[model samples]
Structure formats: structure tokens, C-alpha cells
Target: MCGKGVNGFMKRIYMDHAATTPTDNEVVKAMEPYFTQKYGNPNSIHSFGQEARDAVEEARKKVAHLIGANPSEIIFTGGGTESDNFAIKGIAWANQKKGNHIITSKIEHHAVLHSCQFLEKHGFRVTYLPVDKYGLIDPDNVKKAITDQTILVTIMHANNEIGAIEPIKEIGKVVKEAGIYFHTDSVQTVGHIPIDVNDLGVDMLSMSGHKLYGPNGVGVLYLRKGTRIDSLIGGGSQEKNRRAGTENVAGIVGMGKAAELAEKRLVQGEEDKLIKLRDRLIKEITEKVDHVLLNGHPKKRLPGNVNLCFEFIEGESMLLNLDMEGVAASSGSACTSGSLEPSHVLLAIGLPPEIAHGSLRLTLGKDNTEEEVECVIDILPKIIEKLRALSPFKGSWEGLKK
Candidate 1:
């Protein structure tokens, strides 16, 4: 890891919070006892087991409190993808007799998208709604897409790649009115933004621990009481039989601690700091560079998110250049970063494939400083300039290359 040109300072600047955040020290300390001192199966009935069970239930309560959910409604899962799978497939399987139809947007995380696709192959019907230029799913469009057979409406709360916050509350009203169950894959928004399951009117929602500075391999599916859903992993009687697997005690404890910390941060208005940094990053980059498009809604985006697409150069080239400067960033969702294809979310939002290929995503976190952002703002323009100079896609702007 390094930063900037020869004379420039070299320091590792991590700006990829959407991918994952460093686990908070408090969260790690909370989990340490569970891993060593209190190791026991939560399903056991003995004292050790009861202690573990108590810890798990307490953690469940914390997670529920974070999102205004009842403790009994939280079903622990392996991660966000599994939580999403449980929400989509579990609901689809359980409610197959009610209807065979599902509604979701095209720009959803692959976890939701692929789950819906799998349902389609199994004699189910899915309506893949389109998004506008800002990656927003119109509530009116959702209303129009409903049918008598529509059983579920699964939309994302926020887009990971573009940081576009969907009209989830509005869509929730539409789904509730139609008597269809609603689910939101809120992996990108859960800990980063203020959320209330009741206010959102969602029957089910998905979130991952790692996305909120907790340990990986643990997540939650917040299923509103009485929402008919089947277990995705059926073996043990864990997660109130809604999900079956041995609980990850340490991870769950970490998640609970992380959730507590996140809630405190939100209540303290700490996210406003992220908003300032995010806005500064966006404002400086667009002002300093030319042929750049800021992706997602200008204001209705994640407080820590800044996604942009620079024209005339490949995103990979810019990423590599930035890496040499010791600034860690990404072009899109970390899940699909290895793929050679342009982001589907970018295309869904009306960006051409060439333009989409140049996208960059920078998500801020509590540890990030204004100075670090300033460093990125300083070196990024230089990287983009050098890349553009060597870019073969340069057209009328070729005369500026030197």
C-alpha cells in the first residue's frame, strides 16, 4: 500500500466500507468470551448451554432493537445472501399455494436477483421492474406491476454498487395494500442508515454482520411475526425453526455488539460526519475532473457512499493507479468485482456499457478522516488525468493529452 506520485505522502487510505468494515474493538471484545470462556451449544439445556442460549437471545434482542423488530422475529443466517435466499425462497416455497408471482427491480444485489431467477425456473413467475436514471424503482411502476397472483414484492433498500436508496417505504405501502408480503435486502443500508421495520412496512428484511463492522458468517432475516416462511436450512431447531444450523456464537455476539454501536452512532448523528465526507469527495472529484458522472441520486443516497464513473478510461486502470497511491477503493460491488462484465446496476440506471466500465465506488466509514478524503481528492484527479492521456477512447479531447 502506498499514496500519490513520487514526492507525495504514502499512507493506506481505505474507502471501501460498502464491501466490509473493520470490526470494532468493542465488538471483538464482546465476542472473545463467547469463543473461549463460554463455549457451549446454544441448543443445549445444561448450565453452559443455557448461558450460551441466553447470550444468543440477548444478541437477538439487540439486533431487533436496532431495526425496531421484535426479538422473536430475527432469524439468524449464514450471511446476507443466505438471509436474502431465505426471504425469497422461503417465502416462495411457503406461499406457493397462495401465488406464484414475485416482483423486484432489475438493479438489485445479485443475492436477491439470483434468488428470484431460481424461483422463475421452478414454475414461478417474476416481474423484473425497471429503474430510472437514478437507480430508483418507481412506486407507481410497482403499483402497476401488481397482479392478482403477485405473492411477494422483494426490493432492495439501497443499492450497493451505486448507493441509490430506493423508495422502499412507498413500495411497502403498495405491497401491504395488495396483501402481498414485502421483503427488502437492506444489506447496504441497515447499519449505515436509520431504519425501522414497522415504518418501512416490510414483512421481511435481510442484513449481514460484516457489512456493519461485525464478524462475517453471520446475518439476520427480520421476519415480521406471522409472516409465513419456511426454513432454508433444515437440520436443527435453531432460529425458531425458521433457519436450521448450529449458531455461530462468537459471530452473533460480535454482530449484537456492532449493532449496538451502530445504533448509538446513528442516534448521536455521527453519520452526518460521513455525509460531509461523502459530499466533499463527490464535490471535489466532479469539480476537479472532466467527463465524470456522479452515479445515484444527489441527496437520497447512503451517507457514506460516493460512486462515480469517469469517462475515457477503464475503471481497472484507475483502480490499479489508485492502489499504487495506497488508496483502497473499488469500481462496484465487492461481490462481483472479479467479473469482467460491466455492472448491471449501471446499465439499469441508463449508463452505456463503456461508461459503466469506468465506474468507481468509495464508501466512507467512522475511522475515515477529512484529511484522508482530501488526500484522495488530491491524487484521484491526477490518476484520472494520466489514465485519460493514455486512453485509446480519447476523442475530441485528444488535443488536451500531453
Candidate 2:
């Protein structure tokens, strides 16, 4: 409940929970013992090692329960990027004999997109599907794009920039009927939405720990039983030889704890509260601001996401102004380099460069309160007004009037 006070003039509020969240205190507490007193390699056969091994398994079960998957299906990795790589590259390489074609969307995170690009460089064929204006991928497109040579279809459950929730169940049904493997990068949706791997019919799913108020450097790749995928990192026999490396004991433990907490919150219906807060923020912003447009599906977005595009101002400038005001949010994906190219995801949805450049993403989290939402609403309009006034395009508006 503790957060920065609203200074009205200077107090900053954090609305960018989608980008990343601070590790919860309870998760941190669960991880503290593993980092120091109980630290032991799980691979060791000694009593100390057995204790660590027990914790890892217990954590594994928690992560599995969060997504309605069996404990055996969970494989820990260095985070969402690694899990994505394993799902895309690992599956493509292992199933190369079956076919070399892969299907994914243009709105995917760089992790999945770049992995597909890497496969293409090595002679694999990949089809980048386009999304609707709401950023939702059409399952029919997947069906149309599939061929006898199609080996895998990788799509994200929810977009990071605009929070567009894809129709995973429908997409999964098509992929299943086609007998092609379906991989979903659920980094943004796993903790925010209800995810049942069996119901999703996904052969593989990827999730990042930090997105769920857990420690960073930990991720889970849920490979359905009997799914075929090669090991990306080959070394010692760990993760049943599917992923080889020393287990990130503390991070895994924290991720498991966070996932368990997220499940509990879901059961208690905290989602309704989050959705209300998000909608309120969106309503207030759009009502007060001129030339602003909501950028994603109105009803099909994450409960905590509110993405908008304001005309004339640039995203980086808005982000900087918000940061200076103590409000922490992101203009777009954190993975993009310093190119400032106005988010490929935004452009993929058919947004013009000027509007896309003015995008702002406000993602809520468990720790955010209603007061914080009000504070952001009160402060954001003034900032946008100031930025638009200074923009070079503002002069163009005057010329048009003349």
C-alpha cells in the first residue's frame, strides 16, 4: 500500500506495470533464504543439495498450477526471452524434418520476432501474419497461412505495447486441427489473465518472472507432454536435459511464489478492480485530452493496460515529461534499441507515423491504488498540452487554418 505521495505539482506515479514490476515483498522473503543460508546446487546429492532440489520442485509445481499445466511440463530458463528462443528456435530445429515453415505475427515481441528471423537466415521459411486494427490476430489468417510444410505457429497471447489480447483458444484449435505445433509467448498475459494450457491447446507457452512481481532472470517455458523441442543450451543434464545450465534457484523460487500469489488474486476477483481502474484512467484521459485516440481493443485488452496515441507530440518526449513528473511509464517495448522508429507494433496496426510517435502506454499493477490513477489523470493532460504546443507540427496546423 505504500507508494509515493501525490505532490500534485511533482509527485510521480508509476502506471507502466506491464513493462516490469517490482518483486513482491512476499516473493522476496521466500527467495532470501535460498540466496544465502540455504544456498546449494540442486545437482549435488548431499542433504544441502536435496533441500535446494525440494524447493525447486515445489516452486515448479506452483508455476504449473498458475497456468493449469502439469508439473512435468514446466521448464525453467533465464527469462521470457530465453523461453521464447527455446520455443521458436528449439522447436524449429528439432522439427526441421517435418517442415521448415513457421507462422507468426508482426506484433510479436522482439524475442519471438528475432528468433524467427534467425531461423529464416538458416533457410527456414517464416510467414509474418498481420493483425487487425485492434492488434488481434485472425485465426482464419493462421488457417490460410498454414501449409503441409508448416511446422510451427508462434503468436503472442497479448501485445506488450497496446495490450491486445489474442484469441488463443481459437488459434490453438486451428493449429491443433492442422497438427502443427502452436507456441504462444504469454509474457504479458500469463499473470494478468486466466491461462489454462490444456484449454488453450498450446503445445508450448512462454512466461517471464518479472512480469508477475517476481525476480528477474527467471522464466518458464511450458512444453506440453510429448512435445518435441531441442535444447538451446547444451551442457550438464538439467531440466530433464531439455534446458541445460545451473538452475536459477532464487529466481525460480521467487517466480513460483509470485505465480501462486497471482492465482490467489485471480480467485479472489482482483481482476475486476484492476479493470475498473484501467478504464477510469482511459475514460478520464480521452475525455479531457483533444486529438487523443485509444490504441487497442476496448474490451479485449489486459485489465491493467491503457495505451493511447496523442497527435503532434512524440512518445519519448511524453515519457521524459512523465518521468520528470515522477510518473514511470514506457513509450513502447523496453527491448527496442535507440532507433526511435515509432514502435513497429503500432505501425503494424496501421497507425500513421505521427500518431504512433505520440503513443503512451500506462499499465497498472497490484500495488497501484485508485488515488494514483486520479493523480495520473490530473497531471497527464497538462504535460500533453505543453508538449503539443512546442511540437513543430503545431505550426502546420496554423498554416492549414490560414
Candidate 3:
């Protein structure tokens, strides 16, 4: 809740929860013992090892409970990227005899897209489905894309850039009927929204700890009990030989506590509050800012995600100004922000490169408040106006108007 920026900015407001979240105090408290006094590899045979193993299994159960899966189905990994790589590659390699074709969307995270590309180079066929203007893939497209050679369908439950929620359950039913494995990168939606694997009909799903206010370097890939998937890493019998290397005991413990807290908040209607705040922010921004286009489905998007395009000014300029003004946001996904090219997600949805470059993503977290929204509303317009006044495009348009 502290908003102090590095350059002595008095009021720092973080609106980049989609990139990562601060670890919760309760989660930190739950992980304290494992880091020091009780530290031991879960594979060891000593008493300390037994204690660590017990804690890890208990954490597994907690994560499983959040998603309506069994503890044995959850295989811990490094993080969401690793989980995505494992799910996409694991299924492709395991079911190679059945088929070599994989179906995924163009708007997938690099983790999924790059894995599919890797498979493509290894003699696998990948079908990259396109999305609508609202950033949603049609279930009919998914059905039509399924060929006899298709072995896997890997799509994201919610997009990280635009926050568009995919119809995973409908797509899952199609994949289920086709007898192909289904995997979804639920890194954004898992903790923020209610998820039930059976309800979504996904055989595999990926989740990250940092996305849910847990420690980093910990994630889970939920593989249904009977799903056929190979290990991405070799060696060790950890995770029932499904994943290798010793477990991150403390990080796992923190993830469990974070999951439990998120579930509790859901039951208490905290998500509803977030929705209100998000909607209010959007409404005010649109009403006040001219030439600003809202990206993604207005109603169906993630409760805390507000992606907008402020035309005539580059997104990097807006971001830099926002940072100096003590507002933390992103021009795009953290992984792709460094690229000079416009965001692929925006381009996939048919945005011009210039407009795409002018995009900004403000994602709220549980700790964000209405006061923060007001502060942003007060500060952002001035920044945009100043940037627009200095823009050559704005000057040209004004000259033409005159």
C-alpha cells in the first residue's frame, strides 16, 4: 500500500498487477519457517525433510482445492512461462503418435506462441487462430480448426494485455468431444476469477504464484489424472516423476496461503468491488479523454484491466510521464514492452501500428482503491494533453482543420 517511487515521488500508485503482485503479508508469514529453521529438501529422508514434504503436499491440496482438482493432479514448476512451455510441449511430445498438429490463438503469451513455434520447427503443424475485434476467439473457429491430425489445443483463459476472457468451457467441450487434450494458460484469471477445471473442461491449466500475491519462482500445471503428457525435464522422481528437481518449499507454502486468501475474498464478494472500481475508472476516462479508444470487451474483460489507446502520442511517452507522476502502469505486457514493435495482441485485433504504439494498460490489484482511481483521473488527462500538444500528428491535424 506504500506508494513511494524511487525518484522520491510522493504518491506512487501501482496499476500493473497483471505483470506481478506484491507478496501478501499472510503468505509471507506462512513461508517464514521453511526459509530458515525448517529448511530441508523435500527429497531427504531426515525429519526436516519429512516436515517440508508434509508442508508441500498440504500446499498442493490448497492449490487443488482452489481449482477443484486433486492434489496429485498439480505439478509444481518454475513459474507461468515454464508451466506454459511444459503444457504445450509435454502434450505435443507425448501424443506424437496420435498426431502432430496443435491449435492455439495468435494472441497467446510468448510462452505458448514460442512453444508452438518450437514444435513447428520440429515437424509439428500449428494452427494459430485469430481473434475478433473484441479479442475473443469463436468456439466455432475452434471446432472448424480441429483436424484428425490435431493432438492438442492450447489457449489462454484470459489475455494479459487486453484482459479479454476466452470461452474456455465451450472450446473445452469441443476438444473433449474431439478427444484432443486441452491446455489453458490461466495465469491472469486463476486467482482473480473463480475457476473449476471440470467447469472449464480443460485437461491441463497453468497458474503462477506472483500473479496471486504469492512468492515468485513458483507455479503449477494442473494435469488431469488420466491426461497423457511427458515430462519437460528429465531426472529425479519429484512430482511423481512428472517434474524434476527439488521443490521450492517456502514458495509453495506462500502460494497456498495466497490461494486460500483469494478464495476467501471471492466468497466475500471482493471481486465485485474490483469490478465497480474498474468500471468507474473506464467510464471516467472515456468521458474525459477525447480520441481515446477502449481496447477489449468492455463488459467481459478482467475486472481490474483497463487497456486504452490515446491517439497521437506514443505509449512510451505516456508511460514515462505516468511514472514521473507517481502512477505505475504498462505500455503492454512486461515481457514484450521492451520491443520497439507494437504489441502483437493489439495488432492481432486489427489496430494500426501507430495506434497500437499509443496503447496503455492499467491493471488494478486487490489493494487498489477508489482514491487511487481519482488520483489517476486527475493526473492522466494533463499528461495526455501535454503529449498530444507536442505531437506532430496533432499539429498536422489541427493545421488541416484550420
Off by over 4 Å in 1: 1-10, 333-336, 395-402
Q: Can you list the residue pairs that collide in candidate 1?
A: 2-325, 2-326, 3-325
| lDDT rank order | 3, 2, 1
lDDT tens digits by residue: candidate 1, 1-402: 225445566668899999999999999999999988899999898988989999999999999999999999988889999999999999999999998999999998989999999999999999999998999999999999999988999999999988989989999999999999999999999888999999999999999999999999999999999998888898877787777778999999888999999999998887899999999999999999989999999998999999999988778788888888788888853233677668889989998777788899999998999889999999999999898889877754455434
lDDT of 3 by residue, 310-337 (tens): 8888888888889887889998532337
Off by over 4 Å in 2: 1-11, 333-337, 395-402
Model 2 C-alpha RMSD to native: 2.7
Clashes of each: 3, 1, 1
lDDT (tens digit, per residue) of candidate 2 on 162-255: 9999999999999999999999999998878899998999999999999999999999999999988898999999999999998999999999
Q: Who is ahead in lDDT, 1 or 3? A: 3
Q: In model 2, what lDDT does residue 209 have?
A: 97
- In candidate 3, position 359 carries an lDDT of 90
lDDT against the true structure, per candidate, is 0.90, 0.90, 0.91
Most lDDT-accurate candidate: 3
Worst 10 residues of 2 by lDDT: 393-402
Q: Give the 10-residue window scoring lowest on summed lDDT in candidate 3.
A: 393-402
